[model samples]
Target: MVDTVYLIKKPAEFPIADLISDNDVLILIQDAVLRQPSISNWYACKEDVIARGIKIPDNKLLDYEDILNLIEKSNKVVVW
Candidate 1:
C-alpha cells in the first residue's frame, strides 16, 4: 500500500491526486478534500471538511467510519 499526502498549493498537485487515484484509493485530507467535482467512488476525510469551512455536498461526502472501512479493504491508500 502506498500513501501520498499532497499538501501543496499548486494546481499541479490536483492532477497528482487524479493520477494516483487511477489505481489506488485516494483519501483527501486537509484542504485538498474541499475542492468540488470530487472523484467518483473516492473517500474524503471528515475533519478536513470542518477545518476548511467547506460544505461537503451530501452526494460527495462519506462518513469517517466508511472511509476507514474502505481503507481496511483496500490494498493501498494514497492521499493528495
Candidate 2:
C-alpha cells in the first residue's frame, strides 16, 4: 500500500514537488488529466481520459474499481 493517494481534479500552476513524497500516488481526474507532469507514481482516471480524448498509457489509467481499491489500500487520501 502507498503512503498516500492524491486525487487532483484541476490543473495547478504551482509546483507539487514539495507536496508529494516518493511513496505517494497522484491520480488525475476531470481537467487535471490535461496537465501531464513527468513524475513517478502518476495515474489518471480512465473515464475522464476517455471523455477528454486524452491518450494516457494503459498502466497509468485507473478505472473506478481500481480507484476504489487504491483508496482502500492507501494510508491516506487527499482530494484537490
Candidate 3:
C-alpha cells in the first residue's frame, strides 16, 4: 500500500486534508496540527498538540514517533 504525509504548516493554501484517500493515512504536523478534521480516521501530531497547548479531541491525535513509523513503512511520503 502507498501512503502520503502532508506536513502542513498552512491549512488554507495546500488544504491537504481535502485530498485524503481511503487507502492513505493523513498525519497533520507543525502548526497545522491545531486544526480540526472534518473527516474520520485522520490524525494530528502530538508534539504540535503540546506546542500549541491545545488538547486534541480523543481519537484525533497521534504521537510524532508514530507518524515517523508510518512514514518509514509507507510506500511514499509527501509534505505540503
Candidate 4:
C-alpha cells in the first residue's frame, strides 16, 4: 500500500514551506509551480514548468521517473 503522510492543496499566500523539515520533500506541480520558495528542498515538475512557460534555472525540475525515485528514497513524503 502507498504510505504518503500529508497532502496540501492550493496553498496561496501561506508560508507552508515553514512546515517543511530538512528531510521533507516538496513536489510542486500544476498551479502550485508558479511560486518559487527560497529553499533547497523543493522540486518543480518538469512538464508543468514547461507547460507554464517558466524557465527556472535555480530550481530543480523533476520528471515523472525522477519523482518516483524521490518517493521511493524517502521514508515519508509530504506533498504541498
Model 4 residue 4 lDDT score: 40
Task: Choose the strongest candidate by lDDT.
Answer: 2
Clashing residue pairs in candidate 2, if any?
Answer: none
Global lDDT scores for all candidate models: 0.53, 0.87, 0.70, 0.65
* Poorest stretch of ten by lDDT in candidate 3: 9-18
Residue-wise C-alpha lDDT for candidate 3, range 1-80, written one tens digit per residue: 54665556655434445577776776677777766667665688877888889888757777878887888878777776
The 10-residue segment of model 1 with minimum total lDDT is 2-11
Candidate 2 lDDT trough over 10 residues, lowest sum:
11-20
Summarize candidate 4's per-residue lDDT along 1-80 as a digit string, tens digits. 23442333343532465676776666777777787667677677788889989886744788878778877876776654
Off by more than 4 A, model 3: 14-18
Candidates in descending TM-score order: 2, 3, 4, 1
Determine the backbone clash count of candidate 4.
0
Regions more than 4 Å wrong, model 1:
1-12, 15-24, 37-39
Q: Model 1, residue 67: displacement in angstroms?
A: 1.5
**Model 2 misplacement above 4 A:** 13-15
Which candidate leads the pack in TM-score?
Answer: 2
Tell me the tens digit of each residue's lDDT in model 2 across 3-72.
Answer: 9998988878313678888888899989999987778779999999999997989999999999999899
Clashing pairs in 3: none
> What is candidate 1's lDDT per residue for 1-80, written digit by digit as tens?
42432232322345433465454555566556655434554545666677777776665565667676666766654433
